[model samples]
Target: MRRPLLPPTLALVFALWPSTGCHLLLDGEPAAGIGAPCEQDSQCQAAQCIDEVCASPCSTSAECPAPATCTMAGLCQLPLRAAFVHVGDPATEQWTQAHEIGRQAAHEALPYLQTEIATNKLLASDAASAIDDFVARGFPVIIATSPTLRDVAALKSAEHPGVKFLTCGARSSATSNNIAYSGRMYQAAYLAGFAAARRSATDRLGMVASLPTPSVVRYINAFTTGARRASPAALVEVRWIGFWHDTLPPDAQGKTRERVLTEALLASGCDVIAHQADNGIPVATVAAASLTAKAIGNNVEDACRDDATSCLGATYFRWGPLYTQLLDGIHRSRWPAATLVELGMTLNPAHSTVNFTLNAGSGSSELAIEISNLLQELAAEGGETVPFLGPLCSTGQRDLDADGTPDCLDPGQAPDPQELQRMCWFVEGLVEKQDPADPTSEDRPALVPTTGDCAR
Candidate 1:
């Protein structure tokens, strides 16, 4: 993580220095005032087109507008410095890796954009210094890729009104200068579950899950719901590893907990395994243990790239376009405050936010065919092939309506966005675990959904 290198006074001086670039004007008329569209210096009133914008010449930071710094080129420019903070090593963790890809893509799309990253910011406290350091270094935009940093992002946004901040996976309402954004990944999860079930001969699907976070639970529920849709007899057994990264200590057998749990699931007749964990350990474990068993990847495309033969595609998020759009809005200063931007297949015209990928070697099995078909259906514009429709029930069989039944939803009904974000219950097809320590345990127990697990 980055540390504060310059004192407050010196930092402020550097922040206002030539580390930023100008933003474009809205008008297209030639020789328009600063902030108007321009091609060359002749088209701008200020006689400069710096950073693809009509820019006012400035000798010092004092002559520039607030948050716009005087560049070395003697032009007033908005701070184009942006930083991305990740929870783990992006090289090893698929979730963080996705954001890194986004950051690169954004930079490539906007060459004037300056970007940096701080890794291993797993907590708010860990991320706070990194964010402050970036701010002090003249980064006017901070993109935290983990939900754990949302509170700190909120605090910092209020402290630095000139700086824009964004946090991932946060359902909270955005405030001035800070917005919480997330992708609707459950849609892809449903398709992955359906594929897993279709590929399974025993109709037994296993999931190595991390924390029972609302988002994770929603993914699990959607996965199970999809599996049941494909094969009514399908039962998804979950093994909670308790940590998003699953860096738990290895057992006496010299195996990581994720590997042990994955092997156990395979041993218990689970022909296909899926994971909601941060890393691709489940896919790796399955690839090494069973020749026939397949695993589903999460968060990144080609997650099973290392073990494609043992993999059954993946549900991944492509953050490039979304990041590009958000950064572009910030660059143009058109972003609205206190707004929540939830991108998904239906919302984004490209349908690229939440996506699925199938291995080319998956062959012509029923699973592969169905996955291809579902992908086509989902890719269609304004399609209604959603996964979380009605006729569903919770794991505990709790009554959602007063009709004296355990059904959570009636036929043809769909869960709202808020409900999906705050989902805390699993679907009816989730097999209850007998013992928390035993990943393969099948003994039934009374399970209930509560709000505690929904807290981020």
Candidate 2:
């Protein structure tokens, strides 16, 4: 329920700046480069002409002109000196990839921002130490992108009241001077669901989630709901891989839960699948090779160089606007202490919401357009109410528990955050097991609405 804190005075300043002119710098310095125009690499000393601008060579501290340092990529980049830490399981290349999008955007939007990536192993000691290291480094804004990092962020926010924290897939009530939470991801996930529904061949789908946390739950529910609305015949199976990290050893029961569940769903005739396998490349490749099924791409798909026919399309999360907006706030010296920012489908031409990559040699432009239109309509409805709600039932026969009234309607009476965090049961029509030995089980129940509830 976090709201935007945009003051009228600050809004006016934002209105005046050219749409693309909001860049954050330490002392009003330009982000790209300094000095007069140049045409070639050798036009200026220690500077290369990139895109017609004279910029310094980048590789390391020595490569940079002054004050700037070299990063892990061997690029001479502006040193924000402010540590932007993203904590998640790097093993799941997908989550890592999604966060990388935000990191790249932040780096480009605010030239002074430095970043660090950490993996959460669920060990309390490791989590505590990670927070300590970030604070010790004097990182101003620490972005926790995973559920496991939520408690860590909260604990650290209390200890270091001067540092600012932002979480992506999780939320917390830690409204300390140094901590703020935002859940704009529901918008992204909803869009992803829309994309999945469009590409489904059987109108039967599946979702593999990392954990039952609020962030993941909301995404799963929203996706299934969206799919049902778009294609009532579409059945979405929801599964949980209890662990966020994708590379965990199979539970001692000798059953790789995620793999087993996924195989089961494929055996049961699901054509399209979307899962929170942070490292979706492997899963996508496997699904493509194993089940003759199609995969809905996410962050990693943008950088995919492979010829994956199963990759029908992907849902991309563009964090550039948010970063640019925050940087603008900081530069104008009017940054709000505690604010919630939501970036969805807007008039900004730079934002990329859902990207549909057609199968090679398949003329599917018409289909893609149809899908895009549906997504836009759903997005227009906003996040307060998901597309799937009425007459809902899970395969488990868990009553579509509404007290004779839909849970989404009736303002201020929505499901509590705690309920969302603990969501485990799948909606009706899915064919996944409730208990699986593998912590990363992919088996899930398909979600469908009751007759007369979903749009035809």
Best by TM-score: 1
* TM-score of each candidate structure, all chains considered together: 0.81, 0.66
Model 2 segments more than 4 A misplaced: 1-80, 88-92, 116-122, 178-201, 250-256, 285-291, 301-307, 336-339, 347-349, 352-363, 379-385, 389-456
Total clashes, candidate 1?
4
lDDT of 2 by residue, 18-75 (tens): 2222122234343334222346655534544543333454555765546555555444
Q: Which tens-of-lDDT digit does each residue in 284-313 have in candidate 1?
A: 999999889999998888798999999988
| Candidate 2 Cα lDDT to native | 0.51
Query: Of the candidates shown, which would achieve the greatest lDDT relative to the real structure?
Result: 1
Which 10-residue span in candidate 2 carries the lowest summed lDDT? 15-24
* Overall local distance difference test of candidate 1: 0.72
Instruction: Go through the candidates in order and give each one's C-alpha lDDT.
Output: 0.72, 0.51
